[model samples]
Target: MWSAPTTTAALLTHVVRGAEEAGYNGLMVALTRNADASAQLNELSEEWTSVHDVTGQLIAVLSPDPEVRTAKIRYPIVYECAAMHDLRLVPPEDHDFGFNRCFVGSVHGDQLRGRAEAVPPRPPQEHRNAWTEAASRCASYFGITEAQIPAVLLLSFAERTAVLIRLRPRSADSLYDLCKQVAADLGWTKRAAELSARQRALRQRQHHLHRVVDRPELSRAKWRSRSADRLGSRMTDELRAQYDGLDRHLSSIAEVNPALVQQWRARLAELRSHGTVEETYRQLFAIRRHVIAPQDRQKWRRLAAKVGKVIAATDRVILGRYTQFWNLDDADPITAELRRQEAEMGRQGAEMDRTATEARQELRQIDDELNSVAAELGDIKPKHDSEPGLAAATEAAARHMLGQIDTDTVDGSAGLAGYTVRVVRPMAEAPVEHIDNSLSGTVFGPMVQAGHIAGGVHIHQHGLWARMRRWFS
Candidate 1:
């Protein structure tokens, strides 16, 4: 309960007995209610100077000063005085244990006049009265009773003693700066009419605290600045670390998966007519092995096992160490570029693998074929010029033999207009030599206009065999 805000002083016994019953450390004063107790306070008064604003109030004895910490002192001590009475004691200076600073004094005032001597070191009763009135006015505007004020009041960081409120002594000002800034403009109304710049600054700080934390395009690095120290820096640090970690993962993936052949499968087709995607694919295509899934079923019976059906495809592929960096919300240039490069890298990496694999397989086949033909030719026996001869045949018989051995025919019906389709077949026993399509050229002379043939229409050349062992086996 609050004592009435009377200008008159509270009785000595009420202040001492009330504060002491609440376990105040004024041991000598609490033990004696006689004239001796007042004398003792008068004696110890030098060690702790009274803050004159409410110097005579029941609460004034409580000190929040570091040198004389009285934080354990609670107000409205329980008493058997069913005189139906109660009183609350408030300290002029609330003590600090761990909270951070609320403000700083003026640079010039801090340098020129120390906080203790900023005003008359020991303000006379008249000055105390004036300050008490100013504090009451300040409290009234804040919708708080003087008793409810949490920390010492201040004008501003730059102007410590410019106003009537001050809670720290100059000797201990540097030692005790950590006052929680719960209410900033407690006693700043001293120059409220003229200090436009200070008012703007205070308003700006208040507004800065209302920052958007979850916005997508927070590209500005303001959070890293010291100005943002009180504006949720700890949360920003954690979020930034997560983004960096995800970035590293994507960068690593990009490095290994660099762009290769754009559409390698399509390229291979425009090389192949081609295709596989992994180990089974390699076996099916590379080694030409049948890649069949297992089916455990009874032989020729209605007990055939059925393959399980896939009702729906999965919505997402598993990713490595995912975080907000993988989300589309971060539209910053750096993140977007990384995403593009990584996607391209994946495509190229896949194509390069397929193209390289096919090239290796085709080259192996070529090398084996070359070696086989060379070895077979090396094993051929030489023929003699004076070999035993059969009876000489007629030119007509020779021509007839040539007709069967080297045949050429044309089907004009199936050919294009003004052109005939020429077909040639060499006897199976004959060795491959240069093919002659001259008969068609002669038949169509100037009729067969411009033309181009990409390799052979059909490779009927023979004698070379057993290319790669892998192909057959």
Candidate 2:
């Protein structure tokens, strides 16, 4: 039995080739899709133009010359069985079908007939479902109901595949029986049943999906009431004012340019007569001088600018209405107050951060100076007993340390000065063995001890040993 293939093109080509080889002059194709059948047939004829006969003659005899034997050969007829409701739909009267004879027997003869007859028909319920689905799909495709295309089903066989055929009102029941017999002979019963079931399931799923996706909108009354609530008197007045302003501007421009109407009409006529869209647009620009008077061109320019402003105002009003209805804008008084407070807090936070950063910088500077002094003091330890210059160096270092403290105090870093005093007091108290009994030690030791008595009010003396070493060097 001939089993239908997945693609329409494959099935159509196979059937056409089979019919041609079986000595059929012309074949009628049943179209299931919503399309122009005649146009589709013409295209198909060209697409399958390379099919050949046993003697290497082009099998698609209906193709346009000069590929076919003659240009006079009639093309295959394709009809929308559901839409047309007629099998007698024929080609033009001028076309010849003299050599064409519709085949009733198998194209492969009895060679495959026994195999086709062995396959059994599907259950009645399956057959009914298949039939209903096919009819429903045909109706949906044409945007009609199943009742509009009420017709008995028929099957046409080619190879081992079966093509579903929907017959018109006048179609003979005997023809359907004959087709069934032909299908059985070709062993296409099981394959045809399977294809029909698949088609039914696909159409059902599509119908369900479409229904799910197509949600109904709110009623006109509800929509109108909601829009009215959102669009207050203020918005309406603004929109009306914008509209009136645009109208007044346009009126003024029109009054200044009395020839504008006549010029527009003439330009429109010229545009219609042009060969292409680009040419029409070019002519439109060329006729601008004829349309607008020289003195009124500036008025028109002003009017155009006013129109742009009016459009922008209208867009804003509409957007405002939608925003209010959807609660999309943060325009509530409470929200505005919150935002202002947040901004104030952010500014305060930023100022505090800046002050803290400056304080840290000042403190780091103080720590660096203290560390320098300590390093210089450590260097002085080895040389203090040997050198007499230790006293002058120690005095100089105490002077530098005191100067740094005064400078820090003047720069508004009094906290750094106090911290420096606390740091220096500890270093001054630490014993220096190298400077114990020497004259350098006598002079420097007292000076270093004097730094501790300066208190937190001033920063002094912890680098006496460092100065002594520098003096000796």
Tens digit of lDDT per residue, candidate 1, span 1-473? Answer: 11211111222223323333332111111111112223322222232332222121111222111210111222111121211233222111224411111111111111111112112333233223323333343334323233323113211112111111111122122101111111111212212211332344444543433222112221224212322232122224433343234334334433233342123222322321111111111211221111111231222111111100000000010111121122223334334634655576467767755655665565555456556544543443222112211111111122232244333333222101122222222234657787655444235334322244555465433344544444677
In the range 220-321, model 2's lDDT, one tens digit per residue, is: 343334333322232467665764565555455555555864454455445334333333323333333333454644656544334444434533554332
Local distance difference test, candidate 1: 0.25
TM-score against native, each model: 0.13, 0.15
Query: Which parts of model 2 are misplaced by more than 4 Å?
Result: 1-177, 193-201, 213-473
* Model 2 weakest 10-residue run by lDDT: 417-426
lDDT of each: 0.25, 0.32
Report the Cα lDDT for residue 17, model 2: 43
The candidate maximizing TM-score is 2
Look at candidate 2 and tell me the lDDT of residue 458: 58
